[model samples]
Target: MHRFKGRVGLCAMVALGVVTACGGSPDPARPAGEKQQEQQAASRSGEASPGEDRAVTWANDYCGAVSELVRSVSEMPIIDASSPRRASETSGELLKVMVGGLDRTLDRLDNLGAPPVDGAERVRRDAVATYADIREHAQAALSELSAAEGPEASRDAVSSVRKPLDDLGGVDLLAGFDTVPALQEASRQAPACRTLTDADPDPRIDSPGS
Candidate 1:
């Protein structure tokens, strides 16, 4: 029932590195030896550092999960406002899929832990908070739909969460990588992560009314 909006603007903002939560240049004063160590580690690992690699890896996985969830939501049959029972059933199933996907995504992020690079801790915290907020909103929407007694009430319940859901749709999973030069460069080199482009728009769910 909640109407989500175009995430194009959010994606554009992210592409422009305008996310204050994760925006900043890497520290210029970092020791030269540290850079050398990172390069040496990259050689030994034959890939990015553990932290940057993990961030890219998890980001790719999260993107896949989000894509699948979007596909599922898009494929769902639209329910009539007069068919409250059908709406409830369909919405329940959709929310279940969404909540599960979000949980798994969060779990992967948690397991990956924050990137160990300088100035990345705050970005990681913000990313995790954003994911948690989306999950909370989804749960709340589900609860509202479940508690509604009739078709009109159910529609109203769904409508109430529209903005929250829209906000979730606008979240940029890669926002955390913007501030870390190492991660950004690594993401560019990684095929899986690199495939995600500024021009690639986020997947969207249609409003219930549509």
Candidate 2:
């Protein structure tokens, strides 16, 4: 029910790993242990049924996959602005990495199917739809980036996916599973899986290579 406000740049940080980039601590708002406790209490109260445990587990697995995908691409060489050809090539490679990662992630999610929990059908449906949008839009953004002539153009091209990526980050797929402690903790660690406030600048996109 809580909506996060900010540019998709923040989501980029989540995908990219803010801690790795900024050498910063995790978001202060949701400490892991405390969040787990809260979620456990909620679960005990029957806010989320025991059957939903499987859904929570699946959600956590999905988040882990996303985290890995982001980390993998964030390590790629930054595009050099000084050389136009190199910039284009590097940008294309980065986009290719992103496309491949997203495709794999989406396919994995599809294969996993929805959790066999009561009242989880809707959450599963929405999560799948949102992920599909992310994949499609990311592919489109990759095309634009590949066609871009230079660094500035590539930056602009990459910016095109900001909205859809933001939407992907904003989705609350685990809304139904929130009462599950593990799911809550997992969501906290990976803000892209749900809504949350933005932290300081910790860009995923590295500076141009020297």
Candidate 3:
């Protein structure tokens, strides 16, 4: 009986050693990347145009708000819906309203675009683009979020993209573009603008309450 027990113990040790050997060293897991194929597939399905995003929705609202144009054209005011005079009149009035509305609606754009601030416009746009990019970074960050594998990275990447633009957006628009030197850099290339929240940027400082 003693001899039999000794043989069984020897076999058990050998089996344990073999199992450990086959297990290999435990290594950390790595994150996944956004597959290019997925991007292509989305494009095929009808993705938005390059540089187009929902971030700037105000422009559309501004256009819609200007339903009528009050131009000072000497043409006898024809009330025809399809007439050029009506179209021009509506267009001209709308253009005027847009100046003020744009300043209110797109304060961030106005700040970077109109401000004499250095790199304001470029910085502003790049910041906006960064928000769009962070959505992609989310897929990449999942793989690297674990500390054993690597420190959390994409949060910083996302913030890197959002901060500059958000900080600039915080710059009050009612103050006028003269405060920011980057005003020279502004162009009307942005799409219709909108905000996710109901936050209105215009401060009531200029109001004749005082």
Best by TM-score: 1
lDDT by candidate, in order shown:
0.56, 0.51, 0.27
Cα shift from native, residue 182, model 2 (Å): 9.6
Could you tell me how far off, in angstroms, the CA of residue 210 lies in candidate 2 after the best superposition?
Answer: 20
Task: Give TM per candidate.
Answer: 0.60, 0.47, 0.19
Instruction: TM-score for candidate 3, please give it.
Output: 0.19
The lDDT, on a scale of 0 to 1, for candidate 1 is 0.56
Q: Give stretches of model 2 more than 4 Å off.
A: 1-53, 145-210
Ordered by TM-score, highest first, the candidates read: 1, 2, 3
Off by over 4 Å in 3: 1-34, 49-51, 54-210
| Per-residue accuracy of model 3 over 1-210 as CA lDDT, tens digit each | 001111111011111111121246533362233445645666687553322222122222221121111011111122223643444343333223323333333343433324123444454454344323332332233223221222234233322322322332333322332333322112122221112111332311111001
Task: Write the residue-wise lDDT of candidate 2 on 1-210 in tens digits.
Answer: 332222232244322221121246646896789867866777686564434444444554565444444443444455555665665666666556656756665665566546554444455555567667766776787688767876678668756645544554454434444544554444544445542323322222221221
Tell me, by lDDT, which candidate is best: 1
